[model samples]
Target chain A: DVKVTQSSRYLVKRTGEKVFLECVQDMDHENMFWYRQDPGLGLRLIYFSYDVKMKEKGDIPEGYSVSREKKERFSLILESASTNQTSMYLCASSFYGETYEQYFGPGTRLTVT
Target chain B: ELKVEQNPLFLSMQEGKNYTIYCNYSTTSDRLYWYRQDPGKSLESLFVLLSNGAVKQEGRLMASLDTKARLSTLHITAAVHDLSATYFCAVSVAGNQFYFGTGTSLTVIP
Candidate 1:
């Protein structure tokens, strides 16, 4: 069984605060992703890391960035949070190549006040 | 650029009813996946359709894919309350990135 754990399940932050959400996977997956899910919008990818120190932007990467200093951990950073950034953040990881069936973490519910 | 769209964004049906949720993508891809997400929880992978004409089923849910049509269908048989959740279909592009749909939120009434 694969386990993906997030640093925080629920977080509250004020506007313009720098927020950090961390994810760690035990399966040693090479690909890690960050997505923010909103009502009606579903899951929009923020950023993804294919390997240590490698990252790429996804459909909705504005106001967000990512860090992958190690293989087992991936971090999502909101340089400056806003009220509109309040949503559920999901982290997922998968093996390299074609079989991209992801394993997701419990998710972080961030509330930007 | 790839786009994924799901039909009937909100579905409300009876417990014994049968329904199908459609997922359409705007690109050519052979690998597609179906996932279910309960409220306040993360998504769980349901099926992975890897080829055209591929069909997979578990319990009362069946997922089929058509690569040529760039479409996938998740059918629910005799739906139950336990099956109520947001269903999303994603297409694997370039053997790496996955583009997910807006999701279909299902509500099963008793």
Candidate 2:
């Protein structure tokens, strides 16, 4: 079975705090993605990595950054947590050259106060 | 930029009813995907339609894609309470980035 795991199911952080959300996939996929989901706004991509040490900014990557030190692990970082950053964060992984059928993790609900 | 839109942002139906959710994209893409997300949970991949006139069915759900029209439809034959969730349609434009719709929250009442 394909599995994707997130570091935290729920997190609370104060403003200006640095936060890290980790995601690991057992499927050995080459593509990893981070997205924040908001009500009515849907899931907006924050960042995606195609390979180790290779990352690309997505549509809404202003307040977020990502790192891919290893093939199976992808991390999303918030340099300074803010109230507007409170949302459900999701991580997904997919094959390198396939149709990009992504498998998602359970998600992390981050509350910035 | 690619834009994906889903109509009937919310749907409420009784058990054993039938309905369809529409997904339309603003760009030209042949790859479309449907996902289901329960409340406070992660999303699950439901269907992947990669070509024009592609139709896939699983249990009580069916999905079809029309690439020329940039449209996709998810049809529920007999909806049960288990089918209640938020359904999102995503389109892959040219690369790895995917555009997701606003999603349709479906509630099936028994």
Candidate 3:
């Protein structure tokens, strides 16, 4: 089975601290995505990478950035963590043409204090 | 912009009951996806509807899509304790990005 792994399952950060969430896929998928899931808003995409070193902003990308240094690893960066950024972060990976079926990581629940 | 909306943000049903979750999108899309996520867990893919009038079923759950109307429905035939989870419908646009619905939280009581 295809597997997507996140570096951390739970994290706590101080308000103004820089944070990083990493994701790696074993399937070598071309597309990688970062999303923040909230209670009422569901999952809102923060950023997505279609290829190495390529990134695009999704619907809600205000406080987040992403890096795709290699084909299998994608990282989400929080420039400065804030209280509003506390949410469950999900990472997903899929093949180049197949966007309908994405394999998701276990998710990282970040708490900004 | 693509917008996906799901109806009945919260649903509670008794065992052996039947219900359906509705998903609607704003624009035409090539495919629609259904996913289930338990509390504090990642999402699990359920079904992928590719064309209009496409229907896919697994066990007691059935998903159908109508591309013309940009709507999809996930119908649960019989409620069970293990089937309780949040269901989300997503639409794929421009080949690489997907827009997810707000999600429906389903709870089944015995």
Candidate 4:
């Protein structure tokens, strides 16, 4: 079975705090992505990595960054957490060549206070 | 930039009723996907339509893609409470990059 795991199911952070959300996939996929889900706005991509040490910004990557030190792990970082950043974050992984069909993790619901 | 749109952002139906959710993309793309997300949970891949006139069905749900029209439809037959969830359609314009629609929240009332 394909599995994707997130570091936290729910997280609480204070304003200005640095936060890291980790995602790991056991399927050995080459593509990983991060998206934030907000009501009425849907899921907006934050960042994605196609390979180790290779990352690209998505449509809404202004306040976020990503790290891919290893093939199995992709991390999303918030340099300064703000209340407006509170939302459900989803991580997904897919094959390098086939990026359309992706498997998603359980998601991390982050609350920035 | 690619944009995906879903109509009737909210849908409410009784048990044993039928309905359909429409997903439309702004640009040309043959790869499309449908996902179901339960409340407070992650999304699960439901269908992947890669070509024109591709139709896939599982249990009570059926999905069809019309690449020429840049449209996809998810049809629900005799929906039950268990089918209640948020449905999202996504389109891929490039390798590993997708644009998701606004999503449709469906509630199957008993």
The residue pairs in collision within model 4 are none
lDDT of 3 by residue, B75-97 (tens): 99988989999999999888678
What TM-score does each model's chain B reach against the true chain B?
0.99, 0.97, 0.97, 0.97
Who is ahead in DockQ, 2 or 4? 2
- Report the lDDT tens digits of candidate 2 across residue range A1-113: 88999999999999999999999999989999999999999999999999999999998999888999999999999999999999999999988565888899999999999
TM-score of 2: 0.98
Please give the distance, in angstroms, between residue A93's alpha carbon in candidate 2 and its true position after superposition: 0.5
Go through the candidates in order and give each one's C-alpha lDDT. Answer: 0.94, 0.94, 0.93, 0.94
Candidate 4 residue-wise lDDT, B1-110, digit = tens: 67899988999999999999999999989899999999999999999988899999999999999999999999999999999999999998775788999999999999
CAPRI quality band, candidate 4: medium
Query: Is model 3 an incorrect, acceptable, medium or high docking prediction?
Result: medium
Please tell me which predicted candidate would have the highest DockQ against the true structure.
2
TM-score between model 4 and native: 0.97
lDDT of 3 by residue, A20-109 (tens): 999999997889999999999989999999999999999899988899999999999999999999999999999955444788999999
Task: Give a tens-digit lDDT track for model 4, residues A10-89.
Answer: 99999999999999999999999999999999999999999999999899998899999999999999999999999999
RMSD to truth, every model = 0.9, 0.9, 1.0, 1.0
Candidate 4 TM-score restricted to chain A = 0.96
Q: Candidate 2 at A52: error in angstroms?
A: 0.6
Q: Write the per-residue lDDT of candidate 1 for residues B22-58, one digit (tens) a residue.
A: 9999999999999999989999999999999999999
